[model samples]
Target: MKLKKLSAQCLLALGSLLALGAAQAQERVTAAIPGVVNAGTPIEFIQDGFKGTEGPIAAPDGAVLFTENNNARIIRIAPDNTTSVFLDNTNGANALAYSPEGELVAVQTIEPRVGVILPQGNARTLAVKVDDSLGFGRPNDLVVDKKGFVYFTDSGANGAVKPDPTKTAAPAVYRISPEYVIERIAKDITRPNGITLSPDEKTLYVANTAGEHIYAFDIDAKGKVGPRREFAHLEGLRQTENGPSSGADGLVVDAEGRLYVASNTGIQVFSAKGEPLGTIALPKQPQNLAFGGPGKKYLYVVGRGAVYRIPTLTAGYAGRAK
Candidate 1:
């Protein structure tokens, strides 16, 4: 039944492109994978040696902002390729996004906080303990829905992140609404890490780093999550340093509904229906990525203390928001 529903939706999405005209759907990009990134495009080095970068989001001015997680700062790469410090003492801005109102929201976990970057480049903690709850376990990655609600993952079991029978519960996805009300939507993923919503805004996707699988959930109008189902799996990963299979870390979906997953090997691209599309290998496994440039034509990748840029044929979902 799940496969049938997904197959119908996949065909519907293709028909949506057809209704929009082949030009708008970018039929030329089909030369690559059916719906992933453009193949044969050379990925160029933009900068390197940052403090283990993540959250390479693009600023409105076309500059890119990524967190130097180790150094606890946000670095900006200008359009001219020059790098400089953007914000200091970020509290550990791991993954970032922009609100429709132009505020910068972050998963600042060093202090175990979810906050916003103020206009003057200061940090403001929004929710520290979800209204006196058990406090955030380890807020890893997050995404902001079109309505400014944030969905983040809190992998319950920390400490080397290895699977153990002693672990009581799986990681969970929390929904922080536009009004700042926090709620736990799902809690079955083991070590959920990266997260993003579908292009149609009807589904939410999450990467379970410990489970080595990616899951999807139907999202309602009120930011509530429905049933969870398997979306994709991280393939060909050898055992990690900690006696476990490599898992999906960060994730993003393109306007064409292609899911880009960050894993130990590289960025794994999958179609809307959970079929393997292709892989874009990096020098080192990327931690996260964001699409930017005019019309969202470029992908800015960051990981292993470096950043890379490559042109893309499809626009990114909500990537151009202020």
Candidate 2:
């Protein structure tokens, strides 16, 4: 009788362990955002152990290419989950976008410039210093319009580093014309991080890493942007040891004009009209994200030295490679 009692207790303990494991596995899957993400769809952990992963963009062949900035190399993840080095010695490139001319443009932070880095000899500087004297603080992210204009954000220096006002330009957004003319578009943002344009090219959106809201501007027909306005309030902002920050890092749009923002809370989805849809919480805080895979159905996210993807119900903006 004593042996049977001991056996029953062991079985009960084993069952409890199995149940806890199942619950934890379910927690890995994000909460569905209705039309955006389906319920019970797991946020698949693709790979990890990267150094400063950022600036993910889809290739023409459906592979996702991202910058391992600290490693100074671009890594490509194929559809079959194979990984390969796409480029090296990237000058600390953080964000990437494809020009209308099919060239890869990046915002390099090492030398702090925006330029093309691919096709070997075709590489050339697009914009370096904001002017002859004042250099950019730190070029963080960029996006190219159909007319070949590039819009990027300079996030400025972090708190640890003191920047001289005479040399380092304040945090701002800039536009590089097709003729390679650099224009300062907005300079009032506290810390401009990620940048993107609307699918129709009518609006420009920027994420403020230190602010509580995502900002937007109206784009004119001539590829100029107007006054800045608060588009959507971000979630998961808190008082960190460094100070208060929303942790809004990367921004992207879908085919239907919905905005997907990588924030401290997760991927916060907003409607075209700037209504809050729902947030998809991930296991790790996502610093950047872009749509990739067949038909741009997968949202590839990178942050904190890891990569993750989620099969989404809708697709990314088909007109652009971002």
Candidate 3:
């Protein structure tokens, strides 16, 4: 069943990518913002031609911290459009978000641990090993909420690994509570990648890179996830040989509760009610994104060797999270 669906989507993608390219050239406008936000806002290339960039998150200092996935370095993009390496020798780090204490919380993929970059430029391990019995393979992306609880995805979507039950790891979502307890919040999805909480922090949006769906789950007071429902599917997106083949990679939520998801169709914007609002098309397939810059009105997107900026009317859910 899954293969049949993927085959169909791939066929559609093969036929439509030419049209997609033509459309991108025409608009370069590329993004469709509906339901509330306007779509005419210009999307530009602030920085391009780097190593594989991913996991963009806003820092408290009006700059954006995005990971260079291929090089395992976290680069900071200042408001002035200058880029610098913030942290190096980072074990293939991916996603990053600021904690309540203003520390940079990051997911170090190869080490499979979460670390906090101190204000003085040091890294501290928050959570190591996923569990005693099962562990994380690739700690892909992460999001930190108000009370300092951490939610992240252990997505084994990068390479085709020959499965060894002794070393086999399942892709899932795990949470490190405020009290520093680690627990698996979800394991039903194929490879849980991008994650974000609503402004109210009651709903959690998770993108499955291996599968064609994005799932949303209700968050309890204690921070545990309730039952999940299909939030959205990769309607016009197709698969790739490596990953993100299902379309949804890194996703973010705005203060208006809109979800900005990265896929083969650029960034798909969904309203608070999970309605398909529109797509912010880009020249390259984006790996991750975040809302940063001075007013948090700037959308920073990272992809194969480049970073982009898209100005929007809505702000990010960073300082607005309850």
- Which has the greatest lDDT? 2
Model 3 CA lDDT for position 251:
88
* lDDT preference between candidates 1 and 3, better one: 3
Candidate that would win on TM-score: 2
Instruction: Decide which is better by lDDT, 2 or 3.
Output: 2
**Model 1 ranges off by over 4 Å:** 1-39, 121-123, 156-170, 240-244, 318-322
Candidate 1 lDDT by residue in tens digits, 242-318:
44655688888788888999887788888889888877887767888888767677777888887877777777775
Candidate order by decreasing TM-score:
2, 3, 1
When 2 and 3 are scored with TM-score, the better candidate is 2
Residue-wise C-alpha lDDT for candidate 3, range 204-241, written one tens digit per residue: 88998767778999988876679889887675646467
Task: Report the poorest 10 consecutive residues by lDDT, candidate 2.
Answer: 157-166
lDDT of each: 0.75, 0.89, 0.77
Q: For all candidates, what are the clash counts?
A: 0, 0, 2
Per-residue lDDT for 27-72 in model 2, tens only? 5776778779977788887777898989999988889999999888
Candidate 3 residue 250 C-alpha distance from true site, Å: 0.6
| Candidate 3 Cα errors over 4 Å, as ranges | 1-27, 35-39, 120-122, 157-165, 239-245, 320-322
Query: How much lDDT does candidate 1 score?
Result: 0.75
